[model samples]
Target: MFNRKHLEAILITRTELRLPRTTPEAVGIRSTAIAALLDAWKESGLELHSMMILRHGQVAAEGWWAPYAPELSHMLFSLSKSFTSSAIGLAAAEGLLSLDDAVISFFPEVAPEEPSANLSAMRVRHLLMMGTGHEEDTMGPLSSAEDGDWVRAFLQVPVGREPGTHFVYNSGATYMLSAILQKVSGVKLLDYLRPRLLDPLGITEGTWESCPRGIHTGGWGLMLTTESIAKFGQLYLQRGVWEGKRILSEEWVNEATSKQIHNGDDEANDWTQGYGYQFWRCRNGAYRGDGAFGQFCIVLPEKDTVIALTSGTNDMQGVLNGIWTHLLPALTEDVTADPAAHEALSDKLGSLTLEPPVLDAASPLESEVSGSRYVLDENQFQWTALSVQFESQEAVVTLENCEGEFVLRCGRGEWAEGRGVLLQGAPFQRGANHRMASSFTWRDSETLSITLRYIETPFYVTSELKFNGDELTAQQQVNVAFFSPELPSLHGRRS
Candidate 1:
């Protein structure tokens, strides 16, 4: 049986034993330089979740913000495309498929009765390089198909230009690549790559979201540990060789990482440099596989380094900028051992955490509304009632929504961990038993503010409950979302 937990699983180990840990000086970089990079990232106010810097196949420096530990799997969004590309490379090596094979040939049943010239010319290589000729992304239509036939829906999308002559970041194209791989291999993408790729790297745990047809969503929704991401980057940096054995052909790695098409003209922007097979070319002759909202596996071949990072921020460019500004310089220069700097860097990395809600005194309204259930007006969320109870140092809130009752224990200016229904809707799975951390603070005399962090994913929710006499007004918003971040407000009266 297919388990939903495996698709969005969270591991609970505390130690990172998969990779060798070492001092920054052993990797040709000063410990202070890494500390400085951390300082710069903190100053920029990016919501970084985890970071792992590796050089010479050794973990030089690594850290995870509180609640976002090394054991937990972080969502990789579009970064999964690179893994799908790897599967394609492996399949090609086994003669299961070819780069030049016509994509339409894989699914003749789903193909349009009369395929266009552009669509017929589309090849597996075009999908790998994001050179599909569609004028825009086909995801919108592909996702909204009533029958859930994504392959057929994708094939029907008109190709606006010649496949090899135009470049469009089409995720549906990636999905087609996944469907083709499954068609040729007779198994799921993850299972097919497990023994050949993931197992060789000691990555035994992972999950990929599947489509309605049980195919993995090739372009997004992959979850893996920070260390697992580093291992992947390290493998690519070493030309697909792991432990003196070649897991992937050097020919495939070279062709995949080399710039296959020009993307833009901006010399300063990283996205414009060029594009390879499921990889983005970087400014300093490096390449990377990056996802939306800042999940990155950056490989710097010239410097022999790989940096894995996971974060939640609107400014993806800001992250790469910080890396270029501080971390890039340290990679090239030689530095002597400084025990004091190494100790300082270690301490800083050890203590890294995202600040919780601000500490504030309890509002007098807490006593009046304590244990009182508020009967809420009908809203889109279908929340019918809400109740709050205060204790010695924590606040427990009970909410009744469409999914039934959800109880959250929030610490006062600190995080309280628990497993319960994830109240944030849409992109997040709506069910119980999701790992989360929460903190609450009194914003004013009558307002109670709370922060909910879904630790396994790059998302958090901020809610405010305001009380006036017998009336209650509740407002909630997510930090980032595929849907609208501004959720509907609820008005209610004490019951």
Candidate 2:
């Protein structure tokens, strides 16, 4: 039960989620292998968010780190570039546009009277290969610009070299292709690719961040379930064939996977495996779509395998190093039937689970926020800009600095337990945990109040909650990250 539905659409057909032929009886891996792999993976000190192994197309093994579920969607970061590249391929196959089309074609109205020669020479292919020859980085300049116009501005930058002569990781360049796709197709990148690829592949629940004009952020801001990421890898593994249908032409896939661009001296260079359209070459002779904080869709051609993972890490290259070192050695060219190993592995794999949320670890969490009690409102709440709110089933509690409100219902009778958990605005925004502690209490039997506490203790986040009827408020204190301090206290009562 490794559920990647929230992280990405990982649908391995019962037929595809099989172990190597040498291993029958049960497709599950050996218990020893599972222990060794997890030990090796965690040894790096980086949390393993989601991991999937496809053996001859079947899911051989899968797992997740604590507080992270196979169902939760993790941000794809720059690995988003690969999806954007695939969208272009799907669009090209449908005759919506051509890869060789001029870069200027997408925005005749936006280009300057005297466009740079390098700008004129750039093509869709160039964008896919990170050969745009523009600025070395993207998000910096484009962050504040309008969505429709951002691509053109990116194209206008001075050329670092001739269009195809150099290889730089240009996120803005990827964003431009994403922008161009919308401009010409007359539709968002997600919508266009939804039916052609996502729906067919059963990739659902993917989230894309949008710019002011409502275009999905092309180079980044994609969140996918772990399963969805795996589907992408499998699609690449099968050369674009799925369920007896050819979603993308093998030619396009071959071209995209081939080294169309040259990267640098590092081990994971695009040039090493030879850059394809949007994919880069990995150390294992594999082509991969990777993102910041370690989101990866790695397709191993020679090994006839695929490994898709979503992680939060500062060192991406080191993440791959862990896989290459431990997992690679687990494979053997000499195949043999090992039914006992497979069964034991399957049982061990089944043991992995995420701990349930502690609703009442602190006895103080048990109380009823009742009646309309106007407690002391702190001027400190107005210090931050984030919206915050607090509420109770039979009580009124109000807070400043909060943009949203949460209402708590009594679980039992007069001695009802706390309501739901209160998390901050959003988690993963600053690459940190969402920290909020919420509890409720009843006041005068006519009103209820809630208090949320937050503390980020450098290494992790801890929270405390206190609720009394006369006053309704909450405090967010984090030990890990320092968010703009905002305090919002409000009381809720049946009106």
Candidate 3:
């Protein structure tokens, strides 16, 4: 359980060493370069939600797209691994456990009756470095276990090679680390880190999703604001010291950020540089904690800078490339203010909006089919029927599935906010009530396209409804899908 008094103290620290705001030009950076980066990202079709650039312990530039604000806690996905690693570091510093300790020792009861030689040899360090001997990721098998005993199921999987000799990206390994922390600390990972980390850095509003067993999902499902992420990166930049107090030991920081495994060798890309404990080495002599679809906490040691961003984009690498290409070159040794360029950049940032899909003139078929219900053919989504009703400025789509009716409101050429589900009982939705923004456009005389964006998450669904007399065919696609982008097509007859 979290203490309210401790939380209040943490909130008070928000003012102690709050990052001061300044223009990019004042921090020896060219504002035009930041603009160029934004333009490049927009051109490449990357949907950026928010960004914050910090230099010399001050924020140089910050912006959030309209729907994404500064206060909202955006999901950090795998970036949560870095924070989990921090918890382990804190625990190790307190002498609660050692990195060399055999993982089986923590959960003796859950250990196999006769543990395999490779499994018995596995250590906490192997899990940190993603070197847990398993040739393939274990998350799938662990998740599939009927009993949901994740720890036991993880141990049951054969460790094909000796621990610390192989690297396979495994979220299950990180989950084990979280389980170990909970076992040793006698509390959840978040509670353990509250006083040691979040409070000290003034990061009061953050949440980590938990597994069915109540352990924090260590590899993913962390949520924080962009500033919180920047603060985290800045802590690493200052060698784990925050507000002149050492929160994490310098020794732990060194080990955590240093290359623990050789992941890839492609010199052109940041991800190919190498892998730290939970960080990825970048080409421009930096390291970062990143999540799928571009949640980044980048630390540039050589440049004395930290950057944080949250985005819903497929080209995560492109965001990094833009930073390296545009922002890196702009950092200079001496501070030189370019007021005009700064003003222009600020203006551009303030005006940023994700352009909604454009809608053509109302379809000639609108009047005939506007209020008609269509009975849909059997589909994987289990949607039984759908109907479209167009008003003067917006359209309403009502869909019925196994979960019941969902009325999605869509603007003609804008985003209209509503409460609805893209697909009810979707595994990716995680049972959370959806707050969505939807828009619709006519692709042609017979085709109507709709985009539904889950405002709180990094995914969206696009559906195309084609009309041919009394017959309709609907196709759905997701922007960033977990398994497959393709959704089942629904053939329907007007009723």
**Model 2 CA lDDT for position 425:** 46
Residues 216-289 of candidate 2: C-alpha lDDT, one tens digit per residue: 87888787777788888898889999888998889988998888876766655333555677788777677899
lDDT of each: 0.87, 0.61, 0.85
Report how far residue 382 has shifted in candidate 3, in Å: 2.9
What lDDT, from 0 to 1, does candidate 3 have? Answer: 0.85
Worst lDDT 10-window in candidate 2: 454-463
Ranking by TM-score: 1, 3, 2
- Model 1 over residues 1-495: C-alpha lDDT tens digits? 112233223353534437888989988988877888888888988889999999988999998888677777888999899999999999999999999999999999889989999999999999999998899999999899999999999999989899877778989988988999999999999999899999889897788888889998899978898999999999999999999999999999999999998899898898998899999999989999999878999999999999999998878888999989888888855678889999999888877788787957587778888999999998877779999999877899998976578788988887787777666453575653567888899999889999989888888888899999899998989887777888778899998
Write model 3 residue lDDT over 224-274, tens digit each, in one string. Answer: 878899999999999999878999999999899998987877888787777
Clashes of each: 0, 74, 0
Per-candidate TM-score against the hidden true structure: 0.95, 0.72, 0.92
Q: Which candidate tops lDDT?
A: 1
| Candidate 2, superposed: residue stretches over 4 Å from native | 1-31, 146-148, 267-274, 333-340, 353-495
TM-score of 3: 0.92
Q: Relative to the unseen true structure, what is the Cα RMSD of model 2?
A: 7.7
Clashes of 1: 0
lDDT of prediction 1? 0.87
